[model samples]
Target: MSLKKLISIFFLISNFIFALEIQPTMFEQRIDGSGGYREFIVSNNTNSTLRYKLTIFPGSKKDRDMSKWTEVSPKILTIKPGRNGIFKIFVQTPKEISDGEYDYTLSLKTMDLPKLPGETDKIASAAKLNFDFRLNFIGYAGDLNPDIDFINPVVSTNANGKTVISGTIVNKTPKRGIYCAVNVISGENSLNYSEIRVPVNGEKQFSVTLEPNVKKSDITGITIRNLENSDIILKKPI
Candidate 1:
């Protein structure tokens, strides 16, 4: 199909919104009551004027809303064609807050333009588009590290007639959630690989299928690697 359609499909699968390009879609750092801030840029690539708005939503419980301690300056912005706008994010931890991880979803939406008069009667109207640009915000309270453990793992054939390895991976730390990658090995070769996220003090189910060329009997085990440093978190033998 068209190149634009292909890009849209890829972005949809990756859970990303294609809009005015923004740098640093994720923010993760150590925060305290003293307050800290970060600055990012919004690049306008189109010929028309770009107007974007940012909103922070709670990703946790009502009592754990992180929006209370966070501030995004100039939430609404307008940039000329082919220009960039900079915005700063400031956050502060409360003294009464417990030592742990906090997170929120920051969404960016492009404002719609007003409809022109007498345009639709003679010609097709321009489609008004709205994009949900989600930015992940993660803040850590105190000293913390990622600790992921593989529970029980087993191999079996899935309904699609493919060799599947399934099990549970738990985050043993009370610090914060972690993004990790897992490599499934068979004998001396890597059969499959995938990325996963484990919530703080929570567990997530993982199911990965081996390559078609893999021999099931030679399956060795799995290795969990840190996405940031690529450190071997754990090696589980089955």
Candidate 2:
């Protein structure tokens, strides 16, 4: 579906909440190297107990219309005032998922709440909603799934007797990616570094050299920075 159309649906869905918020406690799907179980965490951010329907976009716009997201639990749950609870949703990847990145969305929607004795309107105004959220899954074909791997401690060498540093970067997303810059810091010594880009399922190499006469022990560590996030200590040797 077109990006504009997809966002419109999210707009409508989020507008219905009343006096409550719904969102993933943690929006990212974290896959360990263990068996193929994918997990998601959802949270309620308000004082009153909340009810929600968890849905997964099976694939394509068609799957969304089919109502394929299986609910993680049936009985309604309660969280004490000023506290939060956890609900786990476990999904098993099919043995034969096509050999590439797959895209999907996990959504938390608030089921309608019963109205007060005299209340006629059912929809809650946006201001009253505590939380609204969406999670996107981008699966990649590499060992670590390009979706989450960010390599730091780029390669470096001596340049004209100066310190130079740089290294390759890969975008682990299943979809196309844009160029991102790395953030670096040097100790009292001058350390030079540059940024590089990698495509989806792709990798690039870069280098930065240290100042002339700079010794290894004088260096502490390198920090890698991206616009959306920051990663550091790519390499540290005493």
Candidate 3:
């Protein structure tokens, strides 16, 4: 198979593993409104009951100063060989955090456990759960209207009577997006459909063709939107 196919398969399996189980089964929250707070969870999937420490930190440079902001919560959980445990944390989310999306990583590790016979010192099996925490203060708010401008929004026909349309995307938002679907709507009905993705701050080209003898006049523009909810349309008559 092609390298592209291999990469796709790799990402698919990675995502599946991520959703299979929660490493830390429990969490405790302490906060003043939306200010800073501590969060913790413990997972015990090993033979012996292990002592652990959990830390949640900012996932960006602006949050790097968080070294001093760290909070050491009380020892929280006792994970049996088969079950996980929970821990409480202290955190603060200031009122100014209600603008866009924020990302964070919750790091969990075995506390300074004494070295065991023939055991490695590495405490964490994997990095803490990394995820983008989006705080949309605007609420469900109305969906923003999207404006799409294709890089090469033109269709070319060949002697064999095949029509191919190609184009690119220019996202004008601070947020990244992934294109989910493409629809070729003609008048009241859609003539052709496809699923495609356009990475954030990037462009992609797709070719859609009609059967031999199908005139271009029957085709309308194509609409492209992201899985994260952004839309762009390519007009044909233009």
TM-score of every candidate relative to the true structure: 0.61, 0.43, 0.37
* Highest-scoring model, TM-score: 1
What is the C-alpha lDDT profile of model 1 across 1-238, one tens digit per residue? 9999777656543432333577554555556667656778998654455567877777565655577778887898777657999888888877767777777778777676554443332111111345567777777676666788998888887666678888999998677877778889876777777887787888999997776656557688999986535688888887
Query: Least lDDT summed over 10 consecutive residues: which range in candidate 1?
Result: 119-128
Could you tell me which 10 consecutive residues in candidate 3 have the lowest summed lDDT? 134-143
Best candidate (score: lDDT): 1
Q: 81, model 2: CA deviation in Å?
A: 3.8
Q: What's the lDDT for all of these models?
A: 0.71, 0.43, 0.45
How should the candidates be ordered by TM-score, best one leading? 1, 2, 3
Candidate 3 off by > 4 Å: 1-147, 229-237
Model 2 lDDT at residue 23: 33
Off by over 4 Å in 2: 1-35, 59-80, 114-133, 140-169, 172-219, 223-233, 236-238
